[model samples]
Target: MLGVPKDEKPTWISRLAAQPAVHRAIRTFRLQELTSAALKVRPIKRRLPKSGIEYRVRYLESFLMADEIFQRKIYREAFEGLDVRSFVDLGSNVGYFPLFAVELTGRRDLVGIAVDGNRSMTDETRWHVDHNHLANVKPLWGIVGYPSDVKEATFYLNPSNVSCSAQPVLNPDVPSKGRIKEVTVPTVDVASAWMQHAGDVRVDVLKIDVEGFEREVLRTCGALLDKTSSVVVEWHKWIASQDEVEALLRDRGFVRFRTISEDPYCGVAVYRPRAS
Candidate 1:
């Protein structure tokens, strides 16, 4: 019998079959190595520059993350041309946004009033302000609601989840697993807070991010919005319907208002109407 040709041999068939498997294994190994290298280099690539205010953020990255910095950047761009002499940071947990505003605007004349419903959060904000030697930023402990000076309310305090609000979050379905400590604190409207100061303070930007209580905050700040040049708020659907918020602002002469993004948790809207 004549021997089979090498190309047509059984051994050759077996080798060809093995070749693809070998190549696939090699490719998989290479991909794994590439992923490992990327994981190693990612942190270094994300490192902020050595100088400037961004570098200072590195000191407090645990408290404030990259997403928060990006949010502040968005706020800065939204109010670029306007002269922002005063800023009201409603629900200013740990003072990240307000501090970032101070850095971006480079306006020492800017006075930031940081209001937080949580006492510990306001205390933390005070610590950061004092540590950074930011004289203009004032931390106040209270909820921004229907203009009032009362010191007693069922202030719900979540020790672990400190950013959660003292006021009942509009979403009752969402479970608050964190502990609630009933703390005593004052409540005031955004307008009253501005009025308490000695001089005729012109509010250029009002940033409200009070979880799901944004609706009540806006209702209380009606007078302040009338005086403010721009109002930036993280709108929540659970808190108030879009139409209701729009109508409220419209009634206060906020003719031009638009949502910046559709982020579920942190959707931002900028309201710029004719100055009063």
Candidate 2:
């Protein structure tokens, strides 16, 4: 897929010109004043309180934004009744989901392998893991896909935003403003990588949120699905159709599982293969 162009200044200007009237109005507002007001409403330096776990949780609520809440909800539902020994967190942007999983499972025996195509995100994840003294998790930097050995692809680096995918996807309706950098990285087959590194280990839960590349990763990891007890994926609308993903999983013996959220844009689906 074509990465964002090296000379993205034109694209950035075009994006600004295409913004909706409401967004344009917001941009015209006193930027610093708006930022100050937001900070006053929710300060960034607020720390988790030192108290009982319940009190700490209450304090933590001040820190969690919308995405964190969504991640927590899915983590709870995915591992509710099962014993999760190992978790494979693909596209683990800041390791928040993996950390949340560790806290939810409450198991020191837990092993987490967090992978992302962005090196900076992986570094941040590593820092967060070490800062929290999480000994069981390992963060890897790479893209996962069907062609494991493929070495070169245009990678789009969206400033400090690591969750943004390197894959080329254009939405005529949505406008974006920012510079993107070109990067080259190694891509691996999910199944082969897991087998090589996590061979003897059984994966209890696998969570994937690779922007638009989820289907490709699944295709590459077909051999490892049998050992996976459950899979949770945030399907991308631009890459593969829902019916296609469902059929692919069905052929592999998995059944569609629902999530609590109704937002189809970021639908979270769980799958468990039928027992023989």
Candidate with the greatest TM-score versus the true structure: 2
TM-score of each: 0.70, 0.73
**In model 2, which range of ten residues has the least summed lDDT?**
51-60
> Per-residue CA lDDT of candidate 2, range 65-144, in tens?
21243323445566756888888888877566665665676654477788888886688578656766668778888777
Report lDDT (CA) for all predictions.
0.59, 0.60
Q: What is candidate 2's local distance difference test score?
A: 0.60
* Candidate 1 segments exceeding 4 Å error: 1-66, 70-72, 159-163, 170-179, 264-266
Q: Per-residue error at 206 for model 1, in Å?
A: 0.3
The reply for model 2, stretches above 4 Å from the true place, is: 1-72, 160-163, 170-174, 262-264
lDDT score of residue 108 within candidate 1: 43
State the displacement of the C-alpha of residue 145, model 1, in Å, after optimal TM-score superposition: 0.8
